[model samples]
Target chain A: MTTATIIQSLASGLLMGLLYGLVAVGLALIFGLMDVTNFAHGEFLMLAMYMTFFLFAFFAIDPLLAAPLVGAAMFVFGAVAYLLVVRFAMRAKANIGMVQIFTTFGLAILMRGLAQYFFTPDYRSINVSWLGGKTISLGGVFLPVPQLVGALVSLAAFGALYFFIKKTDFGRALEATREDAGAVALVGIDKNKVFALGWGLGGALVGLAGAVMAMFFYIYPDVGASFALIAYVTVALGGFGSVFGAFAGGIIVGLVEASTALILPPSLKSVGIYAVYLLVVFIRPRGLFGSI
Target chain B: MDDAHSKRRLRDLIVAAVLTCIAALVPLFVKDVYVQNIMVLTLMYAALSQAWNILGGYCGQISLGHALYFGLGAYTTVLLFTKFGVLPWFGMLGGGLISAVIAMALGYPTFRLRGHYFVIATIVIAEIGFLLFHNWDWAGAALGIDIPVRGDSWAKFQFTRSKLPYYYFALVFCCVAWLVTWWLENSKWGYWWRAVKDNPEAAESLGVVVFNSKMGAAAVSAFLTAIGGAFYAMFVSYIDPESVMTFQFSLLMALPAVLGGIGTLWGPVLGAVILIPLTELTRSFIGGSGRGVDLILYGTVIVVISLARPEGLIGLFAKRRKEVAR
Candidate 1:
């Protein structure tokens, strides 16, 4: 590819990478603490996207404005989900995979159906004034304002998260639970509360990411699946339950996908990601930043 | 004791045969193409789900991407027939072989990741295949590859105008798959598969090569799915990424196994019998024009079943029968 094309791809990749990290952080956190793979995690993001869509359409509010509302709403949603579905599931079976598999898949279908019934399967989007009105000219490269804003917001969120996890009491409780649930319980911290908090936080982060994503992408029932698959690939590549690893992994995947789409046909980019995923699995079963 | 059990099984088999014969003749008496098509589709699903059961049911692999093998079979036979002018009767076997190879390839990395990881890998891998097939120039891309309909030619696998042949063809496939399940259940390999499913560590300690046994089961399972795919392609007389390789199609194939009783021979059959007819009814009633009532119902049913009847309809029956015997 030409130098200009490569530069364009890399710039876009950098922007997309930040959002990927934001989205993936939640997946990593939930998996790290709970050992439960939430198959319906993507649907949480889908719901957030729809919420953002409605907020924008009704009040002329930007997706950024809708972010906190959606995040808070989903945090409660996550807690309720844990209490109602996951609690009962935990009591009944030890084969976490079997219980989670059907439950999450069913939940996904339920959510998709609900969205389709209520929203009518139509494509929804929001236009932000700060996002796309003007472009910044850096040397000879053209960068859109919205993407630059998205990148900055995503980076700030990650920074805030990193600081909170390392500095705060709740974060310490979370980390303790992640390291050893039984030991955390022995230390007088309620493990179930920790789990509920982790799930809530995970859901909130993904919801925020979803709202931001809606600024850049269209909202639809299947949009979550598209991004979620990439997040999954990134999670596997970076490390299953490592937050920092997920951040790095998301960037790496974003670059790989961007570069591949630029050089080859866009349709063939998925094939490249799949190849990388297979290669990583073959070489490092525990992933690049796997705690294992 | 063994001879008496064998005699009892023989008697059951005879009764089942009589029932099957009567069921098979329903289409002959009823001339509605819609009903006939539904019956044919149900039989195909029954066959497909039964094939999936060899791995997901008996071995407890819980693959969500079994459609990969099925798509491979469909595409391979279609390609072979169009390009080489080979008769589909023999060409379909080639499709089966291609599917087996792909299964073995994916099985190496994926089968290592048991339970949820394995399920995710299967889905990701299948999506990869879907993307490739949708974009590849050799495969005709999004436009879809079409198989020329050689009317009334048995060699070409194109029937003149009747859906009856397809109905019978799917019926035979379902029967064969059921027979294969029967053979496995009574065979040493079947016992080994069950051993692996119940306790892999114990089975390994007892000298079962867990990996090889799983691989063998996966290969056979993939091969059978491919055979079903070949028939699927011919029956529809078309092959495309949307129809054959979609994630939705994969879920449809697996739902039967889940709805029936995952590991049992009759589970997939019973699941297909119930689900296909119900799905068809939904399609006719609520799936018309602009209403999404069908999906609404479908999703609700799935949620209810997963929470309330995780063991499926066949499991419920088996449990009842056992309670009665006790």
Candidate 2:
């Protein structure tokens, strides 16, 4: 392959990887804080995409502009979900793991069912004149405007989250709770509040991802299912609870997916990603950057 | 106390025998093709769910990618029959053996990962299978494969006029699955599985050979599921990656077990009996326009059951029975 083609693929993969990382980071954070794997996480992304779609369809709001609102709305939805469903499962006396797991699984189905009932399963896309039909050339590589915006926005969100986690008291408390809920409680931190906040933050991040993606991708109820699997793989490959690991793993997965197209059929791109996932799971279950 | 226990056991056996006879004779009395079809599907799901229970319930390894085995069984049996003119009965056994081997290979490395990691790995494995089959032209790729229709024949495992033969076939499979589950529940391996599930470290300390036990359970589970898949292929007379290897298929297999009672002997059967009819009826009545109401109902039932009764409907019955005994 020529250098230009390689560079172009790498560049596009990197951009896509950032968004993948953003989606996975939410899942990783939630898992880290609450020890609950939200199987409905992709549905959250689906909901956000629909939210963005509605905003664009009826109100003429650009997806970029709708991102924050959608994120905030999803944050509330996530918090409420945790309070109603997850909390109950957490409090169950027996079979805690099975109960919690199926709760989220059920929620995923419910969300998908609701979406199908309302949206009728048709693929919908936002028609943004500026984001659509535009590309920028950087040296030897061409970058699509929507993808560039998605990558930039995701990077900024990641940066903001890193700052919040490292520099803020709330973030420290969240980390503390993840380590030892009782210890955090001894220090006057409400463990439930921290857990709820973690869920909300996770939801908001994926919400932002969905909003940005809606600009360039199709919006459908089941669209989140495949991406959700990819995000889960990214989380596991990144070492479960580590945000930085998720980011790195996402990029690696993206690069692997893109580069494999050079030799493999496009339909089999996921095979390459899954093969890497299996290898990582067997060889280094802790992931590349995970301290845990 | 021994006499009471023996009496209860005899009564349970008699009840089971009677129920089996009734099920076997069902196709004769209820001649509606559609109802028979539903019964066949119910039996198929019961067998699949029981197969899942062997690993997910007994071994405490919630594999969300069971469709891998199911798909493998379907594809292998269909391919053997279509390509080599092998009879489906033999082809079904071949499919089960293939699934068992694959399960062992996968379970060896994956048993080390706990909980969600295992679940995720299973999903990835199934997706890989799905993608590979979807793209491979030899497997018919995205277009899928259709088995040529033939007149009713026991050798081909095909029925043209009546669904009776298929019903009996499904009933027999379902019975065998239940019997296997019953045998496992009474075996030493059953105790080993329960121990590992309750506390792996403790079980290991006591020399439970956790890896081998889990692998065995997975192999058995996959074998049974594959047989179900093979039957499904013949029953449907077509096979595709989307139908057999998707995550949705895995979910459907697990749903009956989860809804009825994971790890329990009759849970899968009860779950299948209840859920299949509910979905089928909903689909016939309002499915065309409503599209997803049944799914919504399923989601609601699952959520409520998980939170309120994780042991499922059987658990509730057991509780009431205990109360009555007291």
Candidate 3:
């Protein structure tokens, strides 16, 4: 109601928006690389959270420490998924687009089932990670420490991603492959290998987001379902296949979500996000930064 | 080729009629309530999926948000029947009209978005509807509606004693949807839709009203899907936001068409028949443990089928038939 409260909420919203960007950027990255939407990108997050949880639960490692481990593990997972599933999906001679959507969707379901089978579908959360239950006040606005750290981590990841895409040899190869997969092959790059690595890179990005999310969010089998839509919205709102657009989209979505919560009931908060998404796409069609 | 095509159309009609006759007699021979229940579900899904095929398959506008119309149909019927004492039959028509109008209205802006943008718009719109219904108190909010038992009569559309009538209604519904698809397949609109699907630019150049074709597909698809939702409300005799309108409902409606063969005439029916029973059996047998075995099997089948036979199992039959003729 007051400007002070508004400022505080907006601050928290900005942080959450950064994490949303992190969650969505991988989807944007993969879509940019190849026109396939994972549809299970959220499940990949769920998996990473579980990985972080297990590492914390058994090995006594903190989630902060577990982030890199989860990222590394998820890289392999993402690459293997591409090789085993997406590779076949890409080759589908008919209804290739639907095939891609459904295959990744199927994988998401299978992962959820497996999670339920092994993890018992019980909601688990790390109660005592160093930053889990802590909060900090900055200029009369209080922010959850986990989300703050998550925002910081997201910025760091984006920075690294910028450099990775703009500076590194692999990043250049990735850019080259994304521009024209067939032509990349003529230039002696293994197209499949590049794609698999792209998938891995995308996977690792979401993995980082998942680790931070595990600090505060409940870890469960179906947890991915809720956020997956938002991730999709963020990706599309920024314009599909543009990673920076995803980041911008995530910030816009988060701010809108926060402002909507201020006006509407919390339950109806998503209406604001969906409305903004529709409004944006309606006006621009391709999204804010989408290619013509 | 034209003669053969006409001959095939006649044979298709005959085959459909014969299949309907055979299906009607199925409950008479098999008296298990559980089996009958699954049969009812299969038929309902067949009808729903058929409606979805009109837009998603035939028109190549893949919508994963049919649940909005389904939930709307259900809500309209239950609200009208419970509050004003209107019969569900009239309610079904009313719901269908509302959904069709809404589809066209939403389609006005959304149809411009190509590919994922359009698909996600449908999802977001449906989600907005779901959230509103979830929070709307007068409409029973998230708890949903429970249809009171007025009587066991065809006029009332409620039969507690036996599901036979419901089964027959579902059968007719399925047949009508299939027949509609069959009819539209050869119509000017149908050809226009296919042309739009294959290549909208080319179709546009060929004088097809691409946007209108998509709008038409949306209206019809939403209308039919709404009818299915109304029937589902009556059949379940209870309606809730979660049950009728969710992301899962949209996916479930689309699954049969996808599994059987998208855009094909028999795809929805064939997919529903094969998938509905398998899901029911799996849920009862292995899913009872809460370990998600049913989901595992279901997911595996989806992945394998999409990979192995993206065209659908109907393609297998078509291939075999061609081989036999050869």
- State fnat for each of the candidate structures: 0.29, 0.62, 0.73
lDDT of 3 by residue, A136-181 (tens): 9898889999999999999999999999999999999999988999
Candidate 3's error at B305, in angstroms? 0.2
Q: Candidate 2 — which pairs collide? A: none
DockQ winner: 3
Regions more than 4 Å wrong, model 2: B1-12
Query: Residue B67 error for model 1, in Å?
Result: 1.9
Error of 2 at B77 (Å): 1.3
lDDT (C-alpha) at residue B127 in model 3: 98
Model 3 per-residue lDDT tens digits across residues B134-167: 9999999988878999989988899999999999
Q: Write the per-residue lDDT of candidate 1 for residues B122-240, one digit (tens) a residue.
A: 88889988888998778778887888877786667788589998888888888888888877877888889999999999999999988988888888889989998889889888788
Worst 10 residues of 1 chain A by lDDT: A90-99
* DockQ, Cα level, model 2: 0.69
- Model 1, span A100-121: residue lDDT tens: 5666667776777677778887
Name the top lDDT candidate.
Answer: 3
DockQ of each: 0.43, 0.69, 0.86
Minimal lDDT window, size 10, model 2 chain A: A283-292
Q: After superposition, how far is residue A210 of candidate 2 from its true place, in Å?
A: 0.8
